[model samples]
Target: SHYFPEMRALLNECQFNNCLHINEPGCAIKKALEEGRIHAERYISYWNILDSFDEKY
Candidate 1:
């Protein structure tokens, strides 16, 4: 899921080939969030879109 373009760029750093960026170990996005590489507000925005996708399907 490339809903978040910034995260997409870091996908290769994740541990899994099909990582969802949620609760997955070695999630590059999560690591970035903790290390200040990614802004918290943008991550929160991602959650909003992720929730909407749940409703859409």
Candidate 2:
């Protein structure tokens, strides 16, 4: 939860609450990506693999 607090604060500061942190404008998460704070592609790959496991069971 280390990043959540700051992230929440950023979201709270955003113009909207339904932010997915994708390509949305004024998205803090996207800003983090631009700053190299988070890896978008890696996260997507990880989630894709995790989601694939659901079909195996």
Q: Which candidate leads in lDDT?
A: 1
**RMSD in Å for model 1:** 1.6
User: 15, model 1: CA deviation in Å?
Assistant: 0.7
User: Tens digits of per-residue lDDT for model 2 on 1-57?
Assistant: 124443544566455578656456887756766787656675465446646776787
- Estimate the TM-score of every prediction: 0.81, 0.47
List runs of model 2 lying over 4 Å from the truth.
1-10, 45-57
C-alpha lDDT of all candidate models, in order: 0.84, 0.58
Q: Model 2's lDDT to the true fold? A: 0.58
Candidate 1 residue 26 C-alpha distance from true site, Å: 1.2
Residues 1-57, model 1: lDDT tens digits: 476778888989999988777789988999998999888988888888888988999
- TM-score of predicted model 2? 0.47
* Candidate 1 regions with alpha-carbon error over 4 angstroms: 1-3
